[model samples]
Target chain A: MSEPEKALAARSLASCHDCALVVRLPAGRAHVAARCPRCGAKVHRRKVDSLARTWALVITAAMLYVPANIYPVMTVTSLGKSQSDTIMSGAIYLLQHGMWPLALVVFVASVLVPLLKLAALSGLLISVQRGSSWRPRDRTRLYRITEVVGPWSMVDIYVVTILMALVSLGQLASIEAGLGAVFFAGVVILTLLAAESFDPRLIWDRAEASHARS
Target chain B: MPEADGREHASPAVADAVIEERSRLSIVWVIPIVAVLVGTWLAYRAFTERGPLVTITFESAAGLEAGKTKVKYKDVEIGAVEQIDLSADLSGVVVQARLGREATRYLTENTRFWVVRAQVSAGRVSGLSTLFSGAYIGIDPSTEGRPQRHFQGLPVAPVVTSDVPGRLFTLRAKAGGSLEVGSPVYYRSADVGDVVASELDESGNHVTVKVFLRAPHDQRVRKNTRFWNVSGIDLRLSPEGLELDTVSLTSLLIGGAAFDTPKDQDPGGPVEEGAVFELYPNRRAMLQPKLTVKRPFLLHFEGSVGGLVDGAPVEFRGIQVGEVRNVRLEFDADTNKLRIPVLIELQPERIALNSGGAVVSIGMDEVRRNWDDLVARGMRAQLQSGNLLTGQLAIGLDFHPDAPPAKINWDAPIPELPTIPSPIEELKTGLSQFVKRLSEVPLEQVGNNLNKTLEQLERTLASANALIAPDSEAGSELRRLLRDLADAAQSIRLLADHLEQHPEDLIRGKGAE
Candidate 1:
């Protein structure tokens, strides 16, 4: 759902999905297409198939996660010798070399943060599917958190890109991204899309339905 | 209660839609499936690349541990110790190591494994860099040998490698002396190989050393090649000059062996592997064809043979014929005389003789036949000082013209050859005899002759004096004549004085010459 339509759902008023303008739908027995006067954009009460789209994107991101960690993100050649390390191993190499602070940062962004976002998204999906209202406020807060943190997972991808660009000393030392980097970046981008396609109004919709039933 | 947003009131048909109809299998599920498949492949690749396991038995696992110690081939780790277990006999440690797949081809029966660490032996210092890099099991692979998975660890590093292109030979010496494993073996004073192994012989009477001569050096080892221990400094001080011989400074520190095929003699042919050669004590000893056939003969010397020891050279006309085999003191109860029995070995080959233009040697029969004649001709053995400073004496055979008459005891068990006193002893005795003969000379008879001659001379002198006496008639006449002679001497003296006073007077006839 767009921002304007999301706030309009609780008050029984039709608001533009793109802009915050409220609009009245013409009375009709057939299909009615509501258009906002101010923004001239199609206004819907909720995003079309919001749950399915978000679920598909989230699943795709989860799928790509495997390859991202399995393959080496880039190869580093130094002094005519080339060495390739995976993300986990790269962090380990840094730690072994006594750069543990950088290793910790990499670990959190590449491993822990991504895994937590997936879990939080899964939890939110499950709660909405079951029509449960348990800790609805906290669940909404968690959704916001997952959205804000989703882009930061791309830090590892950025670091790899920068290293690839900067470390080009030809045979002396050159770093080129590997297959893992592609999959990992795909995961980050897909997760961001999944967060965007999710309709937050669905969270309130399930709680109200459960409250009315009780 | 149902329409919270109030934006849409769905038809009953739409509201009654089944959840399964609304939910559809997404296309994105294919990604997870592909991810699962690729992940499995990567895991399998990692698993298949690990190679076969082999067990190495070592006397002790010093600096070795399970999963930590590496099995390295040329300083690159090819495997690691996976488990350490006690041998069946519990006498040593057996380590199981998993080699990488890349090392499979090198697993051969003849491949050697040894622990490399800092080793300081009398022969050399090696593998010192391993001290910092940590100890590792070294692999020396042989490509031609049959494949094997089990190996026995070497106790020490192999000094001679198979790839070094060398031939192995056995050398027997009375003792190990200072030559050790890794001790350099020299050919013509150039280091060629090393003593690979040393062990006591089964009889324990001698030490058998296994030596390697690498490549072209192996070609240098002829059947007639001579090897000797050149461990310590060899110093010789002689009347001609001083000579010092050493192979190298390392040879002095660790004790090494050197070999050479003498230039003068034929080297015969290249020796085969496992050929047994004798290691002589020094260069001088090695140069001589090792005298294997020795004829023993006993000699009885009358004087002390204190300086004559076994191994002392026995020379015939200043040429070494053999060595003093044994020396003993015997008290002859029958003769009540001290007899010194000396046993010497004579090598007939060492006594060279010239026939026509070529050098020939006399046979043993000829020596025996001619021996009796030589004894009759005053040929005897004597002790001569070979080196006065060291008090070393050698048995010298020569014709002592003044030696006491004696016959060779051909009937004796040992074929005893009579010995004459040494020249020093002979000189001492001859001086003493000369002194005794002088003491027997008659001093009284000589004194009587001298007194008679003196009395006769005195009587003659008295008669002669009476003729000139002034009291007798003949004496007075003689006196008058003597006075006339004195008057003439006085006139001559006066004339010499007048001449001295005036040269013109003599020239003018001393007034009337």
Candidate 2:
């Protein structure tokens, strides 16, 4: 049976998110803060303000992304002359230098992956907010992909940091992190948290609501 | 809250998670808000980094391209070209450049812009390294000039910068020789500088060469410094023998300039920039000149000055104080006399009037006064062969102690100095006088006397021949004398034989040893 079809009859079971324990709640128990028998941790139907928190965090991440790609991530100084490159431009520089594979990896992690994660999170939020469940299973899979790939966008931040440390040669050559690197890192972390707060069962809730309406 | 909302949503509603019990806006919204602030800062920085725009016009845009070619000063890139187009006159290309913010402080009216290309000029080679990196515009901004945005480009790159230690000087020549732009300037056989530029003077009567004499070398230039054309081989066949003369072998082929400053206590300080100096035709000419020409005169002659050429010296007695400006043969129709008029330049400074080596200009009036006195003293100008083998004639001015008295004709059309016959003319006159005296003798009387003398001489010769005849009485007497001499010789030989045997006997008769 599909997940939504199975969730249709699940009003008596309470799953402990902390200890992974399954117990039966009293009949007609509603909105009760209960402790897991094994872990003694408070349990609820879903994460507190899961959709609202995810929405706020995703919007923040999307806003921060504007500056992340607009400004240069780091500056490279050689022979007393300095040149700064944005993430996209750095990727283009790599491509122009005949390192297409490295360029693609940077593009996917630094630019494309973040944008795709933001879009996927927004898609899931919109689908759940509309109480429309066209494909709950597919929607859940999209959220899973978004959560997994969200942290990879921080690759650019790590690259900048390592280059700054390893390439410091006093006046000969040095790499310094630019203001954009901070915002880009912030976007990555916020997006990861947004994906974390996003509730997959909200999608199934929509599916159940549609079934009930019919 | 979501569980309570969802449990309540079981009664009525669109069962999506909507927690209505709390404020709608979450604290997570500040992340996006902070990101917006950072974005605004980044946009401001991007806009502020750009500087003012400048436009430059060049003759050609051969290697320049928009956004690719950079404008550099001292190897530092300060701007980039943004646009290029043909100028309104279609005579050149105009380029617009956008400078970085830091470059704004250095833009000035005297900022010279030149495209750096690998160039080989007549005197210099530059920008070889630019061949790899490609051509770029180079700037030199002089601080003395005011600020400017628009500029006209340099046609040729200037080889020397103002910071380069050198002094510029102008050497004016009668004609432009083989001196090219990169020709060496030698001082005492050492190459010190190069000919940076050469052009005709405004009057176009002379060629003026611009030279950069580098420091230490430049200090060697004095106001009295003499420059000469160190070009061409000077091969002169003189009475001595064949001669080859040149300042240097390289100068003989490519041409060059050599300057020497006579050591003086003053040396007129160091030579000033743009100080004008005459370029002597050759090294010999430079050695002959002690001062510039201060006085000029025209002397007319009735005799031939065939070998006298331009630049020939006019010596007073044996000292050279002037030079021959020109020699021309002209006919005086009124007098029906062929007069050779010679123009000469006399530098009175060659003579130390005060014995202090002071170059005194005894004015033209003083010269005229001396001319009257010299005429009274029978001073005259003559053309003498300077080199007999080469037949080069130089003008000579000397005082003839016994010449006929002649007065200066002050009323003549041109200035007339009294003339005296040359030594050659005097010899010719003496010969002609002898011929006239010879012709003045009574030829008939002398012929009669000569005939009488010849008759007497013939009689004496006939008598001598008759006496010396083999059968004559004198011949017979000589033969008899010869026979007696042979008899006497025979007796003498017998006496000598007796003495040879009794030589000891004669010594003993004297002392019996």
Candidate 3:
């Protein structure tokens, strides 16, 4: 295995996020606020309060996931008969009706994807919060996966919107969005922000701090 | 050297970075708080908006889909059927349904549920729209009575819903006939209501028909109103003539009832809802004068009482005053004879005491005294032919001054009245006596004497024929004499003929020709 590289904080150097200008930081205090001389921008050694912000968003998204799966996402009325379907129930209904392929797609995109993303984000948060230096490489990979797949959970909300807009033929046949759609949308958007606000470099900072202490 | 110079130049311009402390709580925490508030609110609303689940037991689940059927009241949906299961006993299906939150207040014991389907009956056609829209459960909600979640569904839709403004009346009849749910109730040739139910009374002796009369028309019913079955054509062959009566063609097809207060009597007081009225079979029977007080009397007859029956009229001077209770044959042990005792009940109301032609109420003691006095004055009960064609008999009370004196048997259960033989009975007795006298003659001896006389007459005729034979000497003389007489008769006839002509000719003077 290659030798682990030394961190930039150990070299007493911090780069400006806006202008990429390297500046010498005041040593021995990583919490100090600094300004870049080249672009007049506030700079930090890591995203400002990355753990707390991502934790707040992830907690919110996790809270919203409950109602998203509990309540009905949409109600479809056709030929004087009406039916309401939640995400999991819609998948089950499709599967029962001999359309396993469509069921698989819906299950993976709407239910499984959001659930896995929350788990990955929460795992990354706990490991970073605990200051564990174990497998920092895999933790970064998990963060990337959560970021890339977080938006796909919005597939259910889009289906609901398109069906509601297109199927509004008065009383004969109509589609209506339910409260679940709002909560589900919140989960999708919050998870995306949680992934965005997460600092992957924090994964290495913990390892570097542990290594220097040892 | 370039890095060392740059660091020496940058070190002079670079200042220490400023550090500041901020609030521990981040504003991003608001997202989760808003989510908690919204999620809690959504859950609370969902919990509150859900209504109670009710189970209804029905005879069958026909036209009922597990989740498709909706329960509606007055055309507005109030609930939906959620699931269906077979009853434990397997006699019926139990339907579980979820009702709207507001429907909780009206789920009472009297709330009715029935399946609504297209129906065509004799008097009504309903729910035609259900044919295309499919069948659905119907509800007639009632807020009265105890709240109940379990219910027994009705097999058929009710004839009268509670929303209709009406009053109910009960009619007791001998038979149900064609009266059924939805049968019309008529007033003065117009349909005013419908028969809601026709059920047999618990005793099974008669039918109890419940009718609903619409408002305004319902007020027309009075205490003294007479209700009669106007079903089918009423053809009566009465003493007046052949009579035909009917209310309407609709009533003629489907059974119906009609009510009216007689013109001569008062309409009486307004009746309360569910007032019971006796249903008469016909208008004539309903119009019979109502009598409150009756006194029964028995009359023993020695002659046959063949035509007399229960309900036979008892008359006083050709006017009906009572009806026969029954005609019975009894063995009179005291007299050692079989006698027919006819029981009749007299209505005291029909008899008016004339004090200068004014009716006065007579007490029983006064009536007994008067009756005794009348019997002493030769009042007699006799059997009379009421209808010659029908051979129906009636009891006639009339004065018979020559009748032997008799007394009323007041010791009997029903006071016995004295009776005299009817005129027809006397005529029958006379004809039977005449037949007895005619039968006494010896008809066979008379026929034998007549036969002997005829044989003697035949022998005399044969002897006379032999004496007058054509070949005998006496016969020849008689023939010659007969010829001479013929010649004289011919000459006389010619002379008379000539004289007759000459007499007319002489008067006209033959010399003038």
Candidate 4:
């Protein structure tokens, strides 16, 4: 094996004596007999299924993003009357009230954050798949942002829930949850999952391989 | 060394195991999923629950705003304003509102919509809705059929007095400042109606007014209803003092309306649409100066005498009922006529009643009737005065049984009672007249008779003087007689002495011898 492979193999198959599990280097390669599956006892190589499992989750998250935007999430009724306002409409309503800053916050947290996170995660996944030679620093920064902003994307969902719970007027008026809620929830969950499943080590692996060639 | 390395590896493995155990559950996805679910539910609720849209128009939008103002019924909010835009003509504002489905049924064609706010007045009920929501649209529901789109503006306030059904009569009077529209028409001092409208006639001579009464009272206003203006205070004077009659304090503060219905004949004719009735102002008679004497001057006379004093009737022509108003001696300068001017007020109505005259009569006819009565009754004028308490007077008419029938010269002054002479002036005149009569008597002849009588008296005195004169012949005879008398006297004295001596000196003859 080349010197870099040797180093990679050693680092990828580190052993945990207590659990008999293998603490592998963060990479896409598969290995057998790496650890005891039941006890996580130390072994010789890392599990080969980690990369595939992560990629599958990212794919599932991508599929849910479409329906989330198209459907409405809340339905409001007053005095035997009903109307549906989408995310954009609600933001516009707030904006018209001279609450532009608040509207911008809602827009960013609910819409822009979720979409950006999804796109960034997808890009990271694709780059990892291609083994692209990219700046480690840029990639780390992107990853940090995704982690920090991922939680805030649920702001729209939280706001909707809180409003629905608070504005329930028994017979005179009421607000009901719509189909869009479920789809939006799906999008949030899937995007979080996609972010979690991304492999940062893939970037390092490409760097190391390029370094060897140099 | 092998054992030490094994231990070191074991330590690392133990630490790694502990870390893995601590991080068993990755809750990040759960949090986002839950949040997304809630957000989705709320979004669904927002879209499906809106209401209907409606619009209202107002002459001036004023304080109304798109989303702030609400349509209210009995203070319950029924709708919210959606948008406010000026109409194309710019004469008014078109307000778009969102009516809750439940509240839409309340909007009807005849429903009245008006803006409500605070108002100030001296005697008004105001600021009723300020305690609730600020300014709002007040809706008054109507019983008309189906709901319609258009709405009518309601008057800001209710009318203080309304005329729906009542007796309509016109009051004709010389228009004065006191007689005005909205003046109280009082019946027995109670408010019954008000002057609704007033207008001047085309000739500018008369002001016609329309009055309205409320409720069952309207039925009481008959065609012949007498309408009078109650503009000033009604006063009655008595020994006690002056009494003022007016409505209650509240009515006094706001003024009042009044009217009365007569009991006897149903003066009720068809409601005369524009009947101009007589307006007898309480002060009209007092305000008017005596201009032209239409009828004989109304003299109010009064007198107090013993019960048996003359209670004779004052006869114009002697129909029998005009009573004496008063009897006072008047010295007339024009004719130098000393006569009693008896003040008398005759009730033409009573005369008309006895004669059964119509409501209105021509001046010529009335004058002719009076003339005929004057000729037959032997025209005599008298005075009359009303009761002290009432201040009403009527002239009585009666026959002058003692005096011959006197012809009445219409233009000449009516004959009055002879004025009794004042004692002082009568005595002075009598004395002057007696002196003049004495002067006219034949005193010259009386003076001659007096002369003859003086002569006879002088002769008698002369005879008397001769009989007793001392220097005359009678005086000489007297002297001789005196001598004889002296001698006789001496002899008689001696005899009387001898007789006294002789107890009964015989008889007085002896003395004489």
Best candidate according to TM-score: 3
lDDT of 3 at A111: 88
**lDDT tens readout by residue for model 2, A84-187:** 78898899999999999999999999989988988999999999999987989998998898887777888889989999999999977899999789879988
**Residue-level lDDT tens digits of model 1 in B184-268:** 9987678898998889989999999989988887888888888898987877653213558788888888878888888888989
lDDT per residue as tens, model 2, B46-138: 789888788999999998887567898778889888999999999999999998887776678867788988887544578776665567888
Candidate 4: tens digits of C-alpha lDDT, residues B252-298: 44443345444444567646455666665543332322223223322
Query: lDDT (CA) for every model shown?
Result: 0.79, 0.78, 0.85, 0.58
TM-score of 1: 0.67
Q: If the candidates were sorted by their lDDT against the true structure, best first, what order would they fall in?
A: 3, 1, 2, 4
TM-score of each: 0.67, 0.65, 0.72, 0.40
Assign candidate 4 its CAPRI class.
incorrect
Task: Write candidate 1's Cα lDDT for A1-214 as tens digits.
Answer: 5443443333334566676666554432123445666667766666655677677777778878887898899888665445567889899999999999999999999988888888888788888888889999999999999999889989988988999899999756789999889988988888888788788888998887666566
Q: For residues A1-214, write the lDDT of model 4, one tens digit per residue.
A: 4587566545545565565455543334333233445476544332333355455555555555655666667777665445556676667878999999999997887778878887787777677667677776698789889988888778778877887998899756778777667677777776676666566666676676777777
**How far is A56's C-alpha from truth in model 3 (Å)?**
4.0
> What docking class should model 3 receive?
acceptable
Candidate 4 chain B, poorest ten consecutive residues by summed lDDT: B300-309
Clash pairs of candidate 1? B509-B513
* Model 3 score (lDDT): 0.85
Candidate 3 lDDT over residue span B26-80, tens digit each? 7777877887888789779878988888999999998888777888898888889
